[model samples]
Target: MMAVDKGARCLVLNGATLGATGSGVLALFSGGHPLSSAALEGLSATAGMASLCRVLLEQAGWEDGPGRIVAVTGPGSFTGLRATLALAQGLALGYSASLCGVTLGQAYRAREGWSEAYCITRARRDRLFMERPDGTVWAGPSGAIALPARAFVVGNGVSMLDLPQHETLIRADCTSPDPRDIYRAACHADDRPSLQPLYIDAPEARLPSQGLRPSPV
Candidate 1:
């Protein structure tokens, strides 16, 4: 599901870093150009991933250079969510493009062609992070949710079991949301997203029980 957007010259993914439970994946899209994308498996990818994205645009055949880039935010990982979000945020800022986000549920909708879908990912405290077509979120690591009647569900934590919500439910494939989808949905998407990571939820270590605080820079 790729399109030649006069809008974008390159793309990048870090599916492995997000570790979306059963949906861990990493992808990079750069119009076959010298794509400036990042997906570091550990400790973030490139030191200046954003700057690279800008450079990639030139290689992407953009004579004026790609003035924009795109990135995928996440709902958290099997381990946690903080790291990924931080990385995404920084990149978005550097590129000076508007930020667009796609929920895992939206990916299912693309795959299943339904009006409603639940994109579930494993979360801490035995819960799942539920992403919906309307961009609504449910905090359930295991329980299922009703599909939006006209949507499809896809992702790791999602399974089509016959429950009350099952009428609206369908098991979804573990497909991460596409940056293109996010671009379409984002009203703020003026251009490429900065190098900022978007974690849909909090990490267990930062939970009340853990009472841990983020380290200072």
Candidate 2:
């Protein structure tokens, strides 16, 4: 677990598992307690997130910005991950604050207090991102992935996979990891300063068959 100064203001961003309409969570913490939180909706709404965070900080008498920032690095939406990391990086730079990155799977596991669990999330159409208890990660079609018997399943993509009813499976109550859990995970996570998106599958964009024309000299 990372050591943090007492009463330090912290900001947590979790855009990895956005809702269908691009909704995500933003939370503020101080001394390991929540100060405020907001559920941002739609791209247009989230566009003003910086202002919203400023307002929240002001309300809490923290006009200078947070002392630290925690961002959820993802194996989920590519756009969401990129936007979130960019925002976190910008905020950290602007405020001269320390930045930390945590994964959704790590948050879920910590919240569940499970030493062994399967963390899964949607990668794309028919594809899933699975993190085994042993820390191995795999990305592939849901049907192609196999789960252990009596597995403890956690994630938003749980419903997307078709599992056998005969096999015992325990699922978390929520589809997505809680933003608070993300903060908890950040507290225990290594202090690696990386903002890169954890993409499991290759991007869908491809080059056109016709190559670019030569430039005129």
Candidate 3:
């Protein structure tokens, strides 16, 4: 594991697959401060992500690339999450930079200094991804999740669920965790994540009846 220095040049990437847009964010940080950022949106958000990152780095005058790369490991779009991780891993290898991973819930918690709160996000049409107050994450239908009587919910998926009428059911102002929050979490992370995609549910796609082709000898 590589320790992130206060002055290290860091690049943060977030493919917002949990939301409806399928959008993404890229930011450059130096001396523990954000320097520049770019947003990836629309239909080409996944396909053109790498090119955009390159352009962002070039515009920031980081020809040598970043010293560390931080990525959001998600329980969102399977393709989007895979694409983002693939790009992160490839760039890390090419630049010989340290790599770190953080979940949206983790980032939000870290940024807000929330010792306990349920962080939720959309998993699909009816299902939802939730990080429990105890730090355990899971995905399932919204109706299946049982919230505490005086629960505090934070995340974009809050609007999706049908909650009971309770006075203490608090909701946050923001829909999702910001990219800057992710950066802060990465900088102060006590343990380094495996940098793997956090898939709470299986992908929608399935293999063909014939199965996959064999690998070359």
Candidate 4:
């Protein structure tokens, strides 16, 4: 069920980072231009995804043909990461279109003039997920994490850090990665990396007690 033409266009999905209201974002693009973008708020990701699909088919003209599907892989929300990736995978498989995953950090770095910057997002409680200027990732309590001198800091976690006068911080919308940047990052991706979810901490579904339990016959 792949698209007849792989290069016709691409549909980008961004739900890896949940907004304050737990809403997800969806956007469609063709030839580097935005066709449609929407926010799925106060609704289940499943429902939101369905609505997005309808928009792509009806408004974006994907009903007649399929196209590439790209989604954001996260160090953010668990449910969002899983749901968006699953949707992308399913669409790629069904339409036989190329599937790609981009990280929030990558999207941030894709912005022009951004040679180096720190991408940070809120993690469990006081902790945060950070992407260093060197592209390495780290996660820990906010108090213990330190930013490199003179580096730019961005994302939801930026507010948590007390920056020195020498450091520059860009406080922007970290709740959702820009779909255009996600597509740009995908275009520049190397090694054709496998699309997989990025998790920074243990999933909330697992309990601490479960880790100590022994298997029983």
The lDDT for every candidate, in the order shown, is: 0.47, 0.77, 0.77, 0.71
* Candidate 4 per-residue C-alpha lDDT over 17-77 given as tens digits, one digit per residue, 9 for 90 to 100: 6745444577777666777778766426644685667666677557643567778787777
Ranking of models by lDDT: 2, 3, 4, 1
Off by over 4 Å in 2: 1-7, 19-23, 42-46, 165-167, 207-217
Q: Regarding TM-score, does 1 or 4 come out ahead?
A: 4
lDDT, candidate 2, residue 27? 89
Q: List the residue pairs that clash in candidate 2.
A: none
* Model 2: per-residue Cα lDDT over 91-147, one tens digit each: 888888888998777777777566576888877677789988776789998788888
Better of 1 and 3 by TM-score: 3
* Candidate 1 C-alpha lDDT tens digits along 97-190: 4444444444445432554666666555566667766777777535444445535456555542345655655454444554444433332334
lDDT of 3 by residue, 1-217 (tens): 4434533888898884623554568888877778888876644687888998999888877787898899988756787788888898888888878889987777787766564668878777788888886768888888887777767788777877665653467777766567788888787764342477888887678798999989999
The segments of candidate 1 whose C-alpha lies over 4 angstroms from its true place after superposition are: 1-7, 12-17, 20-66, 78-81, 93-98, 107-112, 144-151, 160-168, 178-201, 206-217
Where does candidate 3 stray beyond 4 Å? 1-7, 16-19, 165-167, 190-194, 207-217
Model 1, 192: alpha-carbon shift in Å? 8.6
- Candidate that would win on TM-score: 2
